[model samples]
Target: MATVNPPRGMRDFLPAEKARRERVLAVIRARYRAHGFDEIETPVMEEYSRLHAGIGGDNEKLAFNVLARGLDADAIRAAADDPAALTDLGLRYDLTVPLARFYASHRGELPGVFRAIQIAPVWRAERPQKGRYRQFVQCDIDIIGDATARAESELIAATLDTLDALGLEGGVVRVNDRRVLDWMLSSFGFAEDERPRVLITIDKLDKIGADGVVRELADRGAATEAVEAFGAFLRRPSSADVPFGEQQIRGALPDGVPDEIVAHLTGIGDAVAAARPGESGIPVVFDPFLVRGMGYYTGTIFELAHPSVGYSLGGGGRYDGMIGRFLGQDVPAVGFSIGFERIVDLLEGEADAVDRAIVLVHDRDVTVAELVAVKADLVAGGARVRLEQRPKNLKPLLERAVADGYTGFAFVAAGSAPADIEVKPLA
Candidate 1:
């Protein structure tokens, strides 16, 4: 027999593990609902054109494309030279793309300001590591048709509240505006077309230190003077020294850069502070160098980080022009996505106690009807019950049950009565 295994970067969640994950998801779902966001689900697969439409940034290169099925040899041969010609669709790399398609298709049916909650798996053909999977769940909340800074503030408040509810309080939300980044790049003499390329390099600042970023930029043809100037601004020794305040940022940028953009960043910081008051420890601060990797973000962008995790827990931002690509008219939007897998990994040690009961039949003659009745009774009393034939040694069976997360057990024999089944606590 051939050995069977799950594909690379995938996992099999046994019952106990699945239950734990579902419990965490429940907390997230309830928190989203409490904040008046309505749930929406999009297809796991989407048209290849939509996935490759330039909105996904670097993630587009990692999409898992699906070739058309039932093509004969000649049909396949015809398109062998161009793989994209044979591919009709691809698994969605993230929820934002599908959400944009969904909103554009259903805008008439949705409210003027649509707040959506989506908890679903997204696929990526990238190398997986601890807490990073090729397939993972993203808990996203998006507000469409809202152009004001209030949309960004509400997303920040709701996302932080959700984290706090999951016992992930005190995390920092590092925020930046795309416009400010654009202005900064322009000030360093980068052209409008060169800004995206420079921003992409800058986005890796957290992963690659200042030296690496400067080297990569120079190798990529960024001017020496421009790279040095940008690096100098980004290499400030402390957050206090970084120009984040309205006055400070205005002084750093060119004269014509909008002052309102500075005010917007300041307002978002105040809103976050007001939403999460003293001792909450959830600091929301402006970082001029915080360039989210996604190219679609139009205005305020933010990322969530925690001391417990080595990477960002989740992040999102305003994409005021994305929906227009599909609908032919612009729709202002802002969103935040929680890294569901990373959050679960962080909370794995604090798993909720399992309340399951396993029934072991000591005698072979325990009838099917009797076993069903006992199981039904336990289940009716809100217990997760499992039935098994008693093994030669009760100790080993009980040990296995305990290890498998069964909290209680019941022993049954040939003449056992359903009413008499007494579940004993394991610990």
Candidate 2:
């Protein structure tokens, strides 16, 4: 027989692990509902064209494409040179793209400002590491048709509240506006066309230090003076000194940029403070260099990072133009997606024990009807019941039950009535 194993980057969540994950997901779902966000689910796979529609940034390249099936050998040979033509569908890399497609198709049925909650698995063909996987769930909440800054504020507050409910507290939210980057680039004398490439390079500032960004930009043929000035500007102490930093940036920019951009950024800060006001409140920092790599984020962009985790717990921003690609009209939207897998990994040590009962039939002569009755009684009494045929040696079975985290056990003998089932605590 050939050896059988799961694919390299995927995992098999056994019963206990799956239960724990479902419990976490339950808490998140309830919290999202409380915030007036209705649940929505899209297909795991989307058309290749929609998946690669330029909204996903570099993540689009990681989509797992599905090749056309039932084609003859001659037909396959004719299209062998063009792989894009052969692949008609692909697994969704993220929720936002599919949501955009969903809203476009069902706009009439949805409210003008739809607040949607999507908790589903997304696939990406990236190299897996410690908390990263090929398939993982993303808990996302998005508000569409609301152009006001309140949408961003509500999404941030709701997300933080959900995190707190999950027992994961003290996360820091780093806020930045994409327009701020555009203004900065303009201030540095970078042309509109050059801003995208420069933003992509600047997005790597976290991975590659200040000097590395300058070197990369210089290598990419950016103006020497602009590169040096931008590098110096990025190194400034802005996050710690928002007011002074804002004044300096405003001074550097030409007259074209509006003051409303700064106001919007400040509003998000104030709203975040208002939403989480207290000594134990999560901190919201205004970071100038916090450019989310996604090209779809038009205005406010924020990322939630926990001190315990090396990566972001979740992040989202306003993507007003995404739906426009399909609808042919702009719909203002803002979203935040909690990194479900990372949150689960962080909470693994503190996961609550699954409360369940196992019924072991010690007597082999126990009738199937008797066992079913016992199981039904246990279940009706609000117990998670598992039925197992007991072996000659009860010690091994008891030991296995204890290791499986069963809270209690019921031993059913041959011809025992449902009322005769003896239940005992495992402890």
Best by lDDT: 1
Tens digit per residue, CA lDDT, model 2, 278-333: 74433676666788889899999999988886778889999999999999999999
lDDT of 1 by residue, 245-313 (tens): 565555555467777898887787667777767654337766678887888988999999888767889
lDDT at 261, model 2: 91
Against the true structure, candidate 1 reaches a TM-score of 0.90
Residue 2, candidate 2: Cα error in Å is 4.4
Q: What is the lDDT of residue 188 in candidate 2?
A: 84
Candidate models: Cα lDDT each: 0.84, 0.83
Off by over 4 Å in 1: 235-257, 278-282, 356-362, 367-370, 413-419
RMSD of 1: 2.8
Clashing pairs in model 1, backbone N/Cα/C closer than 3 A: none
